[model samples]
Target: MAFTVKINNLSKELTLFLNWLFSIDIQANMPGKSRTFRCKTVKFWSIWPLPPKVEEVHDVVYLDGIYLARNLCVLICCNDTHVLGWYVCRYEHAKALFNVKTMDQAFIWINELSAWRMTYSDFLREMTVDEFENKCFTHERLLKAESSIWRMIRQQTLFTFLEYIDITVPTTNNRIEGGVNAQLRSMLRAHRGLTLERRLKAVY
Candidate 1:
């Protein structure tokens, strides 16, 4: 009986290890059936790798949200090289991570400029050569005039990175958006059989 119990324990450990390998394969963009066949295991087991804790502060951070479902989105935070962390929340709540004061100021500017009753295109058309060349029509000022149209340009941090001429910061979060989030979406698409809980685990 003791020998039989030892064999059962060994089998359980092997199963757990295979499940972890299965998760790794899935994350590496392997399809469900393909990975299961490669691992020589059934597709019932699922495991999620725990991300290492990040304590160091980065010079520049980029934030973007990727929608997993109609109402659910994962807010991804990353620097140029590595993903810092992510928060899963409703699509509307994703804006909570943004600088509230800056957003409020943008809204105020939009309201003030709305009284002009001019379209963004019209404003551009009427710009003088000096105003355009002298940077009087800066993105911040011009974009504020049409906040509804240039929603992202109003963010304070969007161009603040440019102020630090000494540091190298990317103008766009394309790395996270294109590299990380895009891969995640593709992985989810490949593993459509995952339940909601498993999907969340896979995302984590």
Candidate 2:
């Protein structure tokens, strides 16, 4: 009977811990320690929360990145309501372009354009008067030829969403931005003492 009671108490404590961990608004109202279990909030935080395994793929998903620090960012994937997955990295990259054949072609084209721009700039620096006159007409053309990798990636992202037009996917990821990301920022601000690892765990 005593052992059964202990088990029940432990289970209750575990439930409370999980509730505190995930609850943003509740945390603001709770005390630093669990009154019933006599456990400090730090003890609960010490146990790292694992990200839930996501096997089902949503037809329409939203992707966004939120910066935690100067060099650190978290990329989030979500459907209409729930966050499916997240990745922590130093820099943001276009996930839509990964493992596609067109990615290589786009990079190659951008690289060739960049190389040509560099060559043109160097030529202009050492050109003779007659050479300068010949190339002067091309200066405006060179300016117009400038390419941006981000611009290309943005176009691809838009095209992917356009392909899913028959479905009810939102044109913007405002749900994730206003709901999940906003809550996360608020929670982080409340618990500013968390280390990088713990901060990520909190996010997970």
Candidate 3:
């Protein structure tokens, strides 16, 4: 048992199989513990296994928009405009977009950036080719920066809060995030020398 203190080391395949087994077990139980699996299953699974696949596809997808908005606020507050000039004259806009006060406002601002009609694409098209070329280095870099979030929004249900007005995400709360961080630290402290692969098994 990789989770047991008696075990000195765990192979990658064992970690993958265990993570998958636990995930399936958790899903089936739905907010409660499932019957503990048998050791015999582990022996059987270890012989021939499905290839381990790690997909971070929708991992913390909403956090992308949150992080981007926070970073924009940081850049706006900075004195050096040369570093982030596109946001230079847009301090108020940036503040409103970041909207730390209200979750709904923050969600709206992120959507505005990648919205169909007033999309980032429209921002590019409005500029003369020469001006666009001039802004290529800085502006294009900024554009490319959030391209992934926009892409994710298109594919995922990032706007679920629209239907459920009462939903509050964890990142917005320092208390919950700190508690999670502290738990992680305690885990690492108690189990010194835990590899990233093993740590990720707990996450999976």
Candidate 4:
């Protein structure tokens, strides 16, 4: 059996914070092993002309007898090690960056590159619905507009110029859609006791 920590006046807030950090999952809790948590607690100083001894301070924070366990069934896949797609995207980003001259243009190009990467990352992994809607969707639209401009540039048959630069064909945002489906499944499973705090807590 797993032991539950007591949530009293002093510990109630900390308990809630930890729960938020771990998020939620419905499964059996079995006592595995006990461990201690040690961290440095710090204090702030206002000005430079303060006492040297009191200027910088630190305290030790400790937690004892915490049980930790691993769930064999809750395995998740990671594709970040799959480097070919990312290398291609990076090549394209470098090409775009080289073509742009102004600082503002460079910044926007970088934004699109980052967004493009995020789009692919979400596709390979699972993400929340909000991430799908906000990050992936926004990037897809931007890339579509950019694709048109690139098409016009390529039509000039500047073979030698094109050879020096890399190109990435923009793909559909299907990964973003899949993320939304995963989020929906999470929501449906935890739908019985629907409250604002509970929903937000479960999602975050």
Alpha-carbon RMSD of each model: 15.3, 13.4, 16.7, 20.0
Candidate order (lDDT)? 2, 1, 3, 4
In model 3, where is the ten-residue run with the lowest total lDDT? 74-83
Q: What TM-score goes with each of the models?
A: 0.47, 0.53, 0.26, 0.20
Residue-level lDDT for 18 in candidate 4? 41
RMSD value for candidate 3: 16.7
Candidate 2's C-alpha runs over 4 A off are: 1-5, 18-43, 95-169
Best by lDDT: 2
lDDT for each residue of candidate 2 in 48-70, tens digit (9 for 90 to 100):
54557998967878788888878
- lDDT tens digits by residue: candidate 3, 66-143: 111222211111111111111212122334434434556656766666474355465654533464465333356456
Q: How many residue pairs clash in each candidate?
A: 0, 0, 0, 0
lDDT of each: 0.61, 0.65, 0.39, 0.35
Question: What local lDDT score does residue 196 receive in model 1, on the 0 to 100 scale?
Answer: 76
TM-score of 1: 0.47
lDDT value, residue 84 of candidate 4: 15
Q: What does candidate 1's lDDT look like per residue over 16-60, in tens digits? A: 534544453453444435555446434334555555688996787
Off by over 4 Å in 4: 1-166
Better of 3 and 4 by TM-score: 3
